[model samples]
Target: MKLFHYIVTNRLCHILSTIVIAILISTTCHAAKTKYIWQSSDQFVALEQQDSPSTNTVAPNDHPATVTSETISAMLSSLEIRATDSDKPEPLFTAVAVQSIAPQILQGLRQASPTEDVTFAVIGLHNTSYGFVKSHKVTTGRVYYQAGRLNILIGQAQKEVNDRDDRRLAPFTPGSRHKTSEGDWQLLPQPGQKGFSLQRKDWAAFSTEWQPPAAVQSVSPQQSIPAGLIAPARQPSPADRLIVLKELKEKGLISEEEYRSKRQEILNLL
Candidate 1:
């Protein structure tokens, strides 16, 4: 009977050991699974990857990997799409974060005394001629630099406009869309605002709230003309002089008749 009992106890221990080993094996396999963002092997594939992915039971030694420029651009494009899908009534811009900006552009912006983020702000704009409002809702624009054209974002306009007012001035609650400011501009929130504005003059605010004409830099190289010395002489062209007179008149430097007589006198030279 003692021998029989010993054999049964040994069989029970073996069964328990096998069950524990199987559980550990299953856990190891589960840990080997990778996460979507962890899949850095390819950026485009990573983004366009299964919109819905199953969580793996295990983690790999090294998982979703490095961030490439392609990944950044692709990620930005997705935000743009979200902003587009949601429409608003005021001007909007999407802000993003990066380690550093390109040097040449940074030099120009630094001269403007603009915050570093403006460097990226300069890049995101498709049209250099118009204004962009950073740190706000998407672009279903209320007031666009270009008139008579409608703009929309992946979200609402009033909320964004209000948000611009708040960030440029105060803190706003996340879900509540409407808020007041000195002028009470409507500003909306975009998840995209995360890193776009770390470079602010104020640490308390971290960034100024939205203000119109976020940045406008007009640069023109000037040819120095010595004060006392006359410009070097060249054979004067009648048409060139006429062009100058016309330009001066348009610029209100001279009267229309003055411009006409100047043109006639030059024509007489011909």
Candidate 2:
């Protein structure tokens, strides 16, 4: 009877050990399978985002729509614009007819075939009016609206240069007079406008119309240079000058030739 009890206890212990080992192996395999699934899904999602176009974040005020005074106003406001001139009143946005914008500029902005004649709009903000070209129901380009008429500033220097309420409308940057089969749709500075030219070149005039960078006050060269050339009153030392020159080059303020020339001049002075 003692021998029979001992044999039964050993068989029971062996059975329990086998059950525990099977459970451990099964759990580890499941955990590894789950980890692999998660890794593969994360990689697929990351690849999709990389291939997609940059998403345009919706502004607090943005409401996507076609051309209209009310809609254009909302669109301009959506840009979160600040006034260029403090004295200027809030602008009243207006929709422009499809025919008003230059054909080349119009065509360039709109690539959708079966291109319904797109109606652009002029929005007044930042002290001047900007042409709003629509693409996929969003304002794409801030053009010079209606040549020079809508661009009048609160205190314009050239008040004499004016456009009639009724006039042929063109873009701020119109291509040169030279004939091209598709029309000179090339961007600004391509043909380059002369300051003296009678034609309204608002492209050059208001190139910085949209959110002109904050004004930076600069010291005049004469003010910085001492009255006497023998010794500079405010001139930086050679080491300081080299540092400044390096900074200017890094910031793209000076050309390579100018940098080399100025550096040599400073060295010679030392």
Q: How many Å off is the CA of 130 in candidate 1? A: 39
Residues 139-227 of candidate 1: C-alpha lDDT, one tens digit per residue: 22110001111111111222333323322122221111122222222333334443222111111011222222212354345856458
- Cα lDDT tens digits for candidate 2, 72-130: 23323322212333333332221221112234222322321221112222211122233
Model 2: worst 10 consecutive residues (lDDT sum)? 41-50
Instruction: State the weakest 10-residue window (summed lDDT) of model 1.
Output: 39-48
TM-score of each: 0.17, 0.16
Which segments of model 2 are wrong by more than 4 Å?
1-73, 77-89, 95-161, 164-171, 174-270
Q: Cα deviation of 3 in candidate 1 (Å)?
A: 99
Clashing pairs in 2: none
Indicate which candidate wins on TM-score.
Answer: 1
> What C-alpha lDDT, on a 0 to 100 scale, does residue 107 get in candidate 2?
38
Task: In model 2, state the lDDT of residue 143.
Answer: 23
